[model samples]
Target: DQQVKQNSPSLSVQEGRISILNCDYTNSMFDYFLWYKKYPAEGPTFLISISSIKDKNEDGRFTVFLNKSAKHLSLHIVPSQPGDSAVYFCAASPNNNDMRFGAGTRLTVKP
Candidate 1:
């Protein structure tokens, strides 16, 4: 069974709008959650992250929220731009070394 899941396969948003991506996890032992953005051929790049101890973590236009009790997490992009269009993957790890990733959510930001 997959430990991390992204129910939405894709999302579309207008430029300069907000984009929200949802993710869920089955493993409660995961103490760290991360969001990664991937381009066509490039490797996934780290976006934002949240620890089990914190409910929210933000970095400029990217923000990550985690609900430990619910085993749920989300990534929010404010003022989305066309350049932000990419595949987003949610990841979880207990020791920050061994990680499990969601399928991926393709985000299209229309200009």
Candidate 2:
């Protein structure tokens, strides 16, 4: 089964603080990991990704770390702003075309 899990359905953080997102996976065959950010009624936008061979990936205000041994991954956003308030989804695929997603983590960056 291709099951990706985001245990926490929501998270809140004040502006300019660090916001961390967590995800877990049960499928060992998943080799490509990705994070997507979405606003209401919109499709997800690709944020950052790392291959199974890599442990960490970062892009500016966002960072993703993967621990293969635990089948866990996390996304971190620094200096969060109100604009950053949105739903974040963790996804994985054995290839680029086929994927599975977590329910999502709704991050509210309060002023």
Candidate 3:
């Protein structure tokens, strides 16, 4: 069974708007959650992250929210741009090297 899941396969948003991506985990032991953005023909790059101890973490236009009790996490991007179009993956780890990743959500920011 997959430990991490992204129910939405894709999302579309207008440029300069907001885009939200969601992820869920089945493992309660996961302590660290991370979001990565991947462009075509390139590797996934780190975006934002949240620790289990905190409910929310933000970095500029990117924000990550975690709900431990619900085993859910989400990433929000404000003022979405066409450059932000990419595949977003949610990854979780039990504070170790073993990380599990969601399938990924393709976000298309239309101009």
Off by over 4 Å in 2: none
Q: Which pairs of residues have clashing backbones in candidate 2?
A: none
TM-score of each: 0.98, 0.96, 0.98
Stretches of model 3 off by over 4 angstroms after superposition: none
The RMSD (Cα, Å) of candidate 3 is 0.6
Error of 1 at 86 (Å): 0.2
Q: Given candidate 2, what's the lDDT at residue 69?
A: 96
Compute the lDDT of residue 18 as modeled in candidate 2. Answer: 99
lDDT of 1 by residue, 13-37 (tens): 9999999999999998899999999
Give the Cα-based TM-score of candidate 3 against the true structure.
0.98
lDDT of 1: 0.96
